[model samples]
Target: MKTKITDFFKLVFPSTYSEVAVFLFFIVCYGILGSYIAIHYRIIFDNRIPWDAYFSFDNKSILMTGGSFERHPLSYYFFNWVREFSLFISGGKMDVNFRLTLAWLSNIIITLNIIQVFKYLKNIIYLPLWLSLLITLFFGVFSTNIILSFTPENFTYTLFLLSLYNYYAAIKLRKEEKIPATALSLAGITIGGLTITNFVKVFIPLIFEKDLFRSWKKFGNALFRVAITMICFIVLYLNRIDFKYQNIFSKTNQQYEKFSNVKSMPTWDMIFSFFFGGNILFPGFIMSDKHNMKGFNFKGLYMDLYSSVIPYFFIAILLILISWSYIKNFKNKWVQIIIISFLIDIVIHCVMRFGLHTSYIYGGHFVFVYPLLLGWLFFTYRTSSKMMSFLTLTVAILCTYLLVNNIFRMLEFFWFMENYYQ
Candidate 1:
């Protein structure tokens, strides 16, 4: 066992053990940082307050009582179950355990995402493991702000990634002879369940259709599996105690409309500001008009510093280059599908006028885009000259450095506000 583990490290970090050491160091640092932020930003729901209030009943009863049966019913239940487990372990009290549960889940999801991306790069572009980690660490962490906030969205988001991973695996299996029946069945369930969580996720299966649509027999098998999934969804939907078919669409539409007309920053405006909102060096958090004071109130020095470093034009040009790289690889069906899905997400958000706020944009929307950009870079220049590699490495280091500095500064400012400044 020890020999195998050592061999794995040697495989990942070839010549010296130095790179392996560095990777482990970053892993520890990020683990700590992610846990701290998630705990710090823990949100209380269902009118629960005082940080450590005890629940009124047994954990099982608490979990069964609070659920949004109208949408993502299973996920809603899952979120409550997680909270109940935390409360159970905390001896009927609500405390940091709730946030800790979420933070741990978020960290696990991020690790799984990194693993999936690494596998994709290795299989598709023959990328070395070390380079894969470097790129994944920089962009993965940069795009993970959404996981910090404890919300049902985290559960759905992690489910989405799981579904995507399974779908990717199915596609790969199909490429080699016939896909096993078990693989196809699991893929169908994951994708189908995703629809129940977020209907828009139904489109994700299409991302792999380029490889699945070669022959009628293959396509027919895929359809049969999906049919099974849809039937399962129907049964679940019908079983929900609060199920009201007529009111479902109307309720969803109303929520969408409410979000669109939020008296804060318009969806369109928030998106545009995101580019100019320090997205290159650090994550940007934009407050809306709804949260603004009636009179002038300071948004604090950290916010001012965050707002001051707007490298909009530079970042825009970099994005253009990234897009060009993907276009250059359009012949690769996977590349084409990924780029299209990402663009579809952008267009849908722009038109729907929802998910344009800082949190949503930072948290969830950029997920599709990150993989496209990261994959394109490694695929396009995997065997490039050392100078190119050097430049890429430099950019990764700079982004990591700036991101760590940004996190520390924000933490310091928040601490000061809570302790000394206030």
Candidate 2:
């Protein structure tokens, strides 16, 4: 039995268990630390962290109102609407419990969707545990969607991950010429996610590709696409965001975002932002309160303006750094797969960060690239082996610190529960 298991590991995994085992240590950090941070955001930050320093301090009253982004600020209303609708059914009974349950339920959907994305990638890409662990660690810290927790962005990110999985499923199904029932089902699942918010804005067009959309014999693909969209719309209405919320729509605002495209910055700003832009390496800067925008010249859009510069630098540096390596080992299938995945994600999300498609990974879509890059880097190259071990240790120590903080918070929650329930 031991020999058989060893053989299975050798066949399925890219490297020895040394790296993967270390990564597991980090997972303990992420789960415990991440959960605590999330609850803290709920209790202390109210609904925002990573950026709660500004906008509506409310004398530390702890509320979740408007978000940082205008496009999704409507989500603020949506969550409240959820709380209100629950009250109607509760008839004022167990009102606090109902609101708390809804809040948790929202996060549950996002977390489960992330799990599904990893599961899908595991089956299709055959990534190893070490790869997934390293990537998940990056997501836990830096990804805007994950960092922002319990918001529309988080929900949209979940759908985005699901949409990618469904996309890959469709690709396989189409190759087989007859769409599989399971693929159809998964495709249907993502449509609701997309409609709830523009989660897969960049890649939605790929779903309705010219060939796929034009072909009637490919009715399964079309049906799956349309079905999910309609279902998502229905959900939105059922959640009470139909024509009644027409006031939320804005013709002028929508037009600016869609048509009046912003130009990408020069190469220098892009490079500067990568190191200091606060997306990674230094995320606190973007969320810092010291740089108040209220009095700044570019007041309304300072965050968006500055944050957009980093990914271009990442793309340039990444390409230049990887150039010699790629040229030297062009024939390697593993290298090709890694490069393809990165490019596919970039191309699929080009519009998100102006015209520079290569930069999208540094933007709100960090989760998409974090896993793919780390997976490919750790498994494809042997250099990361030692670094991975050190990172694991670092995260474990950090997690211990985080755990003590969580105990206090958890005690606070318990105290509140006991006093309130009684």
Candidate 3:
């Protein structure tokens, strides 16, 4: 009986009991700490932000609002139910309670996503417990978008990770046997989730087709799964189709054009911004305060802008070089897929021309590159000296620490606002 149970456990979790337990502890700690910070410190930085205000809207108001179901039809219903559930749990219907409830949900999902990342790292590479925890903490701190926010990105990321895991598992299984139904179903679900949440992520499936030409039957199965998921997405999409929100894309395009005329910076600034510009590495420091356009520069509050930019620029260069070096291991399809996916994410954001100020909004989308690069490096150089590994991990932690201080500053800014509002 013990043998059977152990087998079951092994099938379920790729990591050892201790590794899983340690990551689980980290997830819980991150959730609790992150929640306290967000609830006590983080303010509603902007009211104009639609995704941030998602939970604040009641069902009646939500339906009346044109953009409520625009990008995320499925999430619209789900978050409304969450808000209703939270209201019931609190026994009082204050907006603060709703935000708190949704923030907790977001934080938990974020932490779970972090755990999934650590698990993926464990599956791909062998690292010591201390190093693993440090890397996980690095991800928790620097991946600012996942910390706590009621956005569809949270759900999308969760689905993305799950799909990637299942997809990778399927690839391995195909070496021994045919793709299993469970793997196909999981991939289909991911497709559906990505479709409903953000079509931009539709590129994910393309990353998993390394064995396509070798096996037509396997490729056919993948196509079948995608086709079915896409059909479901089309049905769900058509159900929520209203002419009312059709103008949003056109309206945003006009805003984009207007913003584009602000004059492009030097080639160096553009290059630096491409890598470090989007508040990607340090969202807290780089992001402008909600009312900054009204005359408050956050950099002035922190330090000279150059000082802030210097560290992030170097970090960006480090990540890019690390990924590039690892990509030389052309034998590893997973490395290539992740690198390509990261590049695709960067290019899409660039083409959209998210400016220095607004680029932070989509920074979360590309932060997945960090874990991918780390995983690739750890595996490709598993035989490296301890000193080399220590240095690499140190850089990752330092980058995360820089982001942490910025988060504190962000909290401080909110704390200051609290006094004014009170």
Q: In terms of lDDT, which candidate is strongest?
A: 3
Query: What's model 1's lDDT at 107?
Result: 51
| Descending-TM-score candidate ranking | 3, 1, 2
Q: For residues 1-422, could you state the per-residue lDDT of candidate 2 as single tens digits?
A: 79957843433232335434433443444344344433433322222232323211221111234232223323444445554654565475433344344444434444444443354335434556555554444444443333323433333343444435443543444344433444343343333232223333323333434366567756666666556655554455435444545544563257336522544555434334432232332211222223233442210111222444444444344344345345544664434444454454344334243223123223443334444444444344445667656545544443343335334433543353343222
TM-score for candidate 1, please give it: 0.71
lDDT of each residue in 1-422, candidate 1, tens digit only? 79957843433232235334443544455567546644554332222221111111112222334333443434444556666676676676555665455455555444444444545555555567666566656554442432322233433254335424433643554365443345444443433332343443443444365456777877787677656656666666656545567666776677567555645554434554442233334444332221123343222221221344333443454566567668678776566555565565456555555534432323343353454456566667656788457647655755666467556655553464344222
The residue ranges of model 1 lying beyond 4 angstroms of the native Cα positions read: 1-27, 34-71, 143-167, 170-174, 177-214, 262-269, 275-309, 358-362, 365-368, 390-394, 397-405, 416-422
lDDT of 1: 0.47
lDDT of 3: 0.49
- Candidate with better TM-score, 1 vs 2: 1
Using Cα atoms with residue i matched to residue i, what is each candidate's TM-score against the true structure?
A: 0.71, 0.47, 0.72
Angstrom error at residue 314, model 1: 5.4
Task: Rate residue 372 of model 3 by lDDT.
Answer: 52
lDDT of 3 at 129: 58
Clashing pairs in 1: none
- Residue 289, model 3, lDDT: 38
